[model samples]
Target: MLTRTFLHFPQVGERRERALWRFGFCDWHAIVRSVAPSPWRHLWDEWQREAEASLEAYEVGNAAYFAMRLPKSAWWRAIPDFVHRAVFLDVETDGTHRITVLGIADSEGYRAFVRGQDNFDEARERLESAKMLVTYGGSHFDLPVLRANFPDWQLPPLHLDLCPLLRRLGLRGGLKAVERQVGLSRSPQTDGLNGWDAVHLWWRYVDGGDERALQTLLCYNREDVMPLPTLLALAYERLWAQTLKASQQTFLPMMGSKERRTG
Candidate 1:
């Protein structure tokens, strides 16, 4: 199941010094000089002071952050609990420049609606109500597209990002490659199309009114949603196993110190 954890990174502000130590230059100063070609030295002090204050607030627990955690054992259970509240989202855009359509699928079913379609409002309402959002590369693309298209819409927190997680674990390639590595199979209808193709296909139908084109686009969209549950299960399994291993290693060090002291 999709689970979320809020974490406070109190020391993230200290990263500025670390960055300067490693790079031999302050990030803001370097960026400003490179972009403007004019002296931005006066702005540096004010910027650094503001950044330090922001970091202090974060350390003091004034900043909030969230991450999705999925446990491996949860996947093998009779029921996948995470899917109950998770929404699998895929958007079909006219081009990389703009979002044209948003296709959302959940346990209930699927819906494909254009950004300005009559039913787009209803679909957006449903998205806002979901408990968790599951996607492959949403943090970089899908989430931004959704935010841009529906400026007022607020999505549930992301529960899992299969693509980056897989990459982090040294799994290579894109979603399809990960599927193969994990032994997840797909139908021919879906096998032939990738997300970019799906976006193009949907744009064709939405802009041209070709029923056949729409059918293929819907099939592709449905395919995108179908694999999400499996991907989520895999990610949960891997992350949970790693977490357990790390906990054991940490405990061992503490236990060893205690035993030495007692001896």
Candidate 2:
């Protein structure tokens, strides 16, 4: 999908991309092979160069170049080895702009960056290094809070928000609630907890400097992100099925927990 996305090129938007599709330019390769030679051909030439470079980077197991064009897109399914390039992100805040804890998990491990307790730069570095970022509701909540929290540094180039895709699949609820439908659940300590509980836990740590409370907060936050890979894969499979809805096959197997595992 990333390879077929033309919106990454300059002067192209959703409308322009659709126009390209109508003009018989359906994929990146199609645009590159087009011989119409319009005035916008220069842009396509430049994009061809970048697109080839991105694919090459992905082929070499290096996401460095492709990561630069990371934005919300349906193209991820086409990008090879995308699971390893992704980092799932979630943040706990005070219902406003104050972020008390920022959690991100990838193949490396689950990481929690607490305010005043750990180095914020560490989390920033980890996120910046990731090629893609996945979030459940980051479009409205997590990403805004993170940007406000770190005005200087930029997040990963691409962000995949699961909220819309989940809604399309009839999975409508909070993160934990949606997880429940899919047999994903939190541990005993974090079970039945809500956002308010997280706030109280943070307050407990801030007031008494209780590391236990802090640890619990981290654990709660970790649950928010741990199941993202499976969720993302499930979303992709569903969306792909929709594209082939005309087919007689009515069911697509969901990605297994083992497949979602980073290790």
| Maximum-lDDT candidate | 2
* Model 2, residue 64: C-alpha shift (Å): 10
Alpha-carbon deviation at 126 in model 1, angstroms: 1.9
Supply the TM-score for candidate 2.
0.72
Assess the local accuracy of residue 47 in candidate 2 as a C-alpha lDDT between 0 and 100: 66
Candidate 1, residues 55-129: lDDT per residue as tens digits?
Answer: 343243221122222132222211233245568887767677477656777757777775555478777777766
* lDDT string, candidate 2, 45-93, tens digits: 6767655665566556554454455444554443234567678999998
Task: Pull out the clashing pairs in model 2.
Answer: 1-75, 1-78, 2-75, 70-157, 70-158, 71-158
Q: Which of the numbered candidates is closest to the native, going by highest TM-score?
A: 2
Each candidate: RMSD:
13.8, 5.8
All candidates: TM-score: 0.60, 0.72
